[model samples]
Target: MNKRVGNQTVRLESKPRIISTATIVGPKEGEGPLRDYFDTILQDDLNGEDSYEKAEKSLLYSVITAAIKKANLKEQDINYLFSGDLLNQIISSNYAARDVDIPFIGLYGACSTMAESLGLASMIVDGGFANHAVASTSSHFSSAERQFRAPLEMGSQRPPCAQWTVTGSGAAVVGTEGNFPYVTYVTNGKVKDYGIKDANNMGAAMAPAAVDTIKQHFMDTGRTPDDYDLIATGDLGKIGRKITAELIKDYGYNMDNIYIDCGEEIYDAEKQGVNAGGSGCGCSAVVACGYIYKNLLSGNIKKALLISTGALMSPTASYQGESIPGIAHAVAIEFGGDKNE
Candidate 1:
């Protein structure tokens, strides 16, 4: 016999699973823009002429290993590793994985790395290919900025909604059989874009993507907005969340009590001085791995959807006058049942 709990459906013979997550910072705590882990590692001459690729390699290597340790999993026990980053050819992930003795598969979805990883990881377990897997992504502001835009010290004043690329790495371990929480459902997002000119206001640019995914999830699953206890978007900050709500309502969906944005929840809006919210691959990854996973395990929140939204445009693409492309992928995670007992 099978039973359903909130959004999670478990088969009688099926096993419950959980994702253990961890994060590593380049910069110490209480630092301003470019003062955090990403910038410190990138700008510091500690490596003595280390290239951008080298800096990324060093940072990701430490973080992934630390995350594995925190999860208390051995390298051989991990079936596969799915990782991505904003570097060319995913050098950071590749180089880092080399030190570990696990099989590796690289993935790229721009800022949607975490969602892409979770979606794929869920499929691996649900399809019975592998019982255990790990998903990770990383970004460093100094390296990303230098590669995408100008040098770090350019003193460029960003727009109100611009998000700082998190200088951190996060990882999660998922098992098909355990007392761990299971990923119940996932909806892959299609690329959507609004003609927003400036890259600074990412929330406005990504608003349409978030709205489309949320609407599509409801339609495809025959689920209503009220069906979910909490509808959380990955990194859509204040502006994007508001826009997303309005657009969903326009499409005849009301999500008043259930809607929240991960970006806004990660940090204090007033203290962080972020008018809108956080953005970047790490934004969703860290919050999910750190906060959401903890709460779910502790039974604080029963059912939730993690919709990670990404703006899939590079500086070159934007400079060539290309319209920004966006994507949002949703993964439903839930807790509570006989398995917990």
Candidate 2:
């Protein structure tokens, strides 16, 4: 039987497989280095919608449909759809679920929502609560800016440490039967706030949380960085990546060569002018579904650990002069190729 390991980690004996996935991104993200990995790329950020919020919803809807289609399943086949976004009330995910007509459970972990969704969906399948489920998350640059920072028209100057919000959505279909990457374990994180009030430096604010989760995951699984082909973190741009590395070393683990960050890999920083790098809910989601998932399917990667970090702060929180709180969730995935083949 699958059982809980340590305090926060759950080991899934059934190994729910991620059978298929889909990704959609805006023009800016389309031009990034990971362009070929995406399933759909919009010509513009608006995506034929009048508002950025609507565009985010459309992205979510398209990605979810595409994921189901890729899995050779229909909307009716999904037992539950887990999704969320950075917008207030998670309106993008809510509206997308309404369009898809699937039983919906909205989640909110800020940008860590993708990992949260994936972890929960995998548990549902492994526990036999549901045979098939979809995990999805999205974020739009414009929408995130308007809600978290400033309106586009305001043209607020971003500080050097600020990361760019990814305008995209990613969805994954998971089930018990498939020759694909299987989720083996999940380590949920606790909220950590270091009392850093600089909204522009989110990487610094979230680094400790990422470090905490990574350390705890290693302890729970009794695995080192060398146990997996790669260990990736979500949205912890260059600054946070460095901080995480140093902090993890301080925790007595050296993750220098085996670790990579989705934020750092998603774009060519110099060419894209993305400052620190990519953040937002879609940053890790798209990279996982598009790049890492494909690699696993092709046997380019045997096993990996994906840790998604999120800054659990809002504009209201910032305005209230509250420190940014951060959280991270990790999932261990192994390639389970076609058995018959």
Tens-digit per-residue lDDT, 1-341, candidate 1: 22332342222224336557766544421243322212123335223336755765676666566666766778888888888888778888898889888889898777778877877777776667777778888776667777766787897776677766666667777776666667776777788877886777777778888888777777766677766667888777888888888899988899989888767765566766656666667677766666667767887777777788888768878888987888888777777752221
Query: Per-residue error at 37 for model 1, in Å?
Result: 17
Q: Lowest-scoring 10 consecutive residues by lDDT in candidate 1?
A: 32-41
The lDDT, on a scale of 0 to 1, for candidate 2 is 0.91
lDDT of 1: 0.70
lDDT for each residue of candidate 2 in 1-341, tens digit (9 for 90 to 100): 74899988999999899999999988988899899999999998898999999999999999999999999999999999999889999999999999986899999999898899999999999999998999999999999998888788987888889899999999999999967899989999999999988877888888999999999998998887777888899998999999999999987888899788888888888899889999999999999999899988888888878998999987787888889999999998889442212
Global lDDT of each model?
0.70, 0.91
Candidate 2 TM-score to native:
0.97
* Index of the highest-TM-score prediction: 2
Among residues 3 or more apart in sequence or in different chains, the pairs in candidate 2 whose N, CA or C atoms overlap within 3 Å are none
